[model samples]
Target: MNFYAIKAIYLFEMSRTFRTITQSLLAPVISTILYFVVFGSAIGSKIQTIEGISYGVFIVPGLVMLSVLMQSITNASFAIYFPKFIGTINELLSAPVSTLDIIIGYIGAAATKSFSIGILILLTAHLFVPLNIIHPFYMISFLLLTCFTFCLFGFIIGLWAKNFEQLNLVPMLIITPLVFLGGSFYSISMLPLFWQKLSMFNPVVYLISGFRWTFFNVSDFSFTISLIATISFATLCLIIIFYMFKTSYKIRT
Candidate 1:
């Protein structure tokens, strides 16, 4: 339905990405390489293996997840927030596109960008460390789900934000901290028992754990739990977005 409308919006967003190639794509890739240099060289030397996987290799999934999560949120939030900031959202609102169509256009483009970044980072990882993927199917599944879910969450952020500062608030303050503490650089098992239990409450842990499991069949939580948590979070974001669009929250005004 309204395929043409979706295509126009999608193309517009994609073109903007190309225009900002340095920031949108290259920046994250460069940052990830730095992480490899610092963590893989300095820290990886001290800690040889976590669950029998080399420290450098062990962190690959986490690093990719970190980049993907942040980029997904950044891309989606900015895509819609720019429209709101410049007063062009009203034009899109008046278009014949349904809410789903609009969401698909924006969210799809954002997810695609993040997904491409994920693939690029994975390929880049090979240059630094020898890597192995035990279950490629599950790895791709988790990557796709994470991209779509976070992009949707970012879209919600775009809608709720009234200013630029507010737009950066969640990803920088909340999500970024959660990721670092969520076992991105080390396993939660390395934590003391109490902290290990406490780590369970941080949602990003499950995401990184589940993705790591796909690579080495190792994780802080059960694979089943991780999958459920990922899907549940996605579903929750979808519900909130549906309600927002239906009520015209921050869109109609």
Candidate 2:
């Protein structure tokens, strides 16, 4: 099914990342190390623990999730958006490739980048505190699904964007805030009852909660709910991408 075409696009996108490794990889690594320093060292020493896990270790999942979410969006959005911005998108569109091949190429590369960052952050996290992964299978599952889902979400943003400002809009304004408020740094149970109830409305909460569960076996929501939520979100993204390609949304422009 046009495997060579898909490989060509995928490798090209990946090569761009290597070319910009300092910006694409090192930046996130340095930022995460800073988070580890400030939150894990300074604050963690004062707080001691959350739900019986050391605060440093407890924050690992959230920290990784934060970076994954941001990078997934940033990478995918920029990859597709740059083509649109520079008028190369029309060339790709007219090429002998199916929509699925194009999506697999772009989103696959983006997902791989985000996935690498996730694993990198995980290894970096170990320098600050000893960590335990209670459920390794579930942890990888959550990470894989999260990378793919958010990469697809970023693809949608890339397609819908009309300018650089519009391109950065969702990841900066919407996603980052949702993650902060979504119990990324703290447990929802620490919130008052009202805020706890309200937090459920934020979809990022389930993602962080479920990922956290795999690490320490502690969660704000049921693991089943988190699994279901992630699957549903990915499915929804797939549907929307298909519709956009079918309608040539923004691409025909």
Candidate 3:
């Protein structure tokens, strides 16, 4: 399975993360802490609770999901895009590793980083407000699933991008907005009925809802539906990536 080749690539990516520890790790953690300060401390003191859960506690899962999604995409996309930008991708391509091995290496490393950030954020949240994990198993399951899925999606972005601008385009313009509107800080049920219905079209809502459910046993959609939506999105990303790799899209050109 070319384990050595995969290990080399994996270690290289992980080492890069360590080298840029401030931007790669601390930045997201600090951002999340700020969110807790602004939203949890300032705003939460005014509002009593959302669905009987303290406003601060209610937002924990969403905040974690937000950070995880952004970091996973950023980490994976940059990891591969840098290679393409600097013309080192050809060297990796020339290596004996198969496509699956290469993907496992890069995506695995990115997911690990994002997963670590998610856990760190969760621990950080405990300092601000008490937390009760209704389903610990499901919580970890959702966190791992979200990390791997978004990392794969980011891998696709890396492959499709041609420049630095294009690499940052999707996560900044598209993903950030989705996470904000996806009930990260407030419940979708609190929205106007019309907006609530419209929010259903946003895929990020399902992810946040499902993750929040694991914490509070409450969600905008059924757990089964959220699970299905998440898997469906992951599958779609996989199909798109497969086509790109087969066509050598934005690569070997």
Candidate 4:
């Protein structure tokens, strides 16, 4: 792997992000504020506290996760997809850059963008509700882990997608719906026993619950279980992504 090549790719990607900084960063922040205003202030007043934390505060982790999840996916997908669209991907492929270098370059930028946005959203939430971090280390760890895993998953989506419409399909359709139904705004305890069992199938539930535990020191499920699920899911996603990269699936004939 060439150091110069890696640096070139990273700097180029970062430049592209800078060109549209407002849409990438500020728009997400604005949407997050709207959520705080509408849901936290308007709807939450009618709801009681969860684990001694106000409904608004309880939703903070989920909001952070939402920001990280979307940013990671969109950043990674667009990074690769645009190269393919502009005929630059073939140049990189034919260049001396190894596939590992390519993956690291793209995923690193995506994670960085996602992490920055996640923290920004958390900071923005501070204006609306005072948040308490019962476990700061765990909170940061989960946030990074979530960002890394989704970035890898998005890379796979980028490689597999054949067009712009296909690229946005998974995030807009699958990921968004999963997050909403994953108890981001509500607790599964409010659900009946049957629905509670069903909710377990949604992987985002573990992520949201784990993040909530970091803030309130209370969780719907064991914190250890969430850690294990996150680790396992990330590992599986990495394996699949590595395989795709190694095989050059959908990248070459």
Per-residue lDDT over 57-137 for candidate 4, one digit per residue giving the tens place of the 0 to 100 score: 988888888878888999998889888888889888898987778877888888888988999999999989998898999
Following a full C-alpha superposition, what root-mean-square deviation does model 2 have from the true structure?
0.9
Residue-level lDDT of model 2, residues 1-253, one tens digit each, is 7899989999999999899888887887888899989988888789978899888888899999999999998889899999999999988988998889988999999999999999988988888778889999999989999999999999999999999999999998999999999998899999999999999999999999999999999999999999999999999999999999989999885
Give the Cα lDDT of each candidate: 0.93, 0.93, 0.91, 0.88
Off by over 4 Å in 4: none
The TM-scores of all predictions, comma-separated, are 0.98, 0.98, 0.97, 0.96
TM-score of 2: 0.98
Q: Give the TM-score of candidate 1.
A: 0.98
What number of clashing residue pairs does each candidate have, in the order they appear? 0, 0, 0, 0
Instruction: List the pairs of residues colliding in candidate 3.
Output: none
Model 1 agreement with the true structure over 1-253: per-residue lDDT tens digits: 9999999999999999899888877887798899999999887899878899999999999999999999999999999999999999989988988988988999999999999999999999999999889999999989999999999999999999999999999999999999999999999989999999888899999999999999999998988999999899989998998899899988885
Q: Model 1, which residues run further than 4 Å from truth? A: none
Choose 1 or 4, whichever is better by lDDT.
1
Task: Report lDDT (Cα) of residue 87, candidate 1.
Answer: 90
Candidate 4 colliding pairs: none
Least well predicted 10-residue stretch by lDDT in candidate 3:
244-253
Tens digits of per-residue lDDT, candidate 3, 74-168, equal 99999899999888999987888777787889989999999999999998998888999998999999899899899999999999887889999
After the best TM-score superposition of candidate 2, give how far the Cα of residue 130 lies from its true spot, in angstroms: 0.7
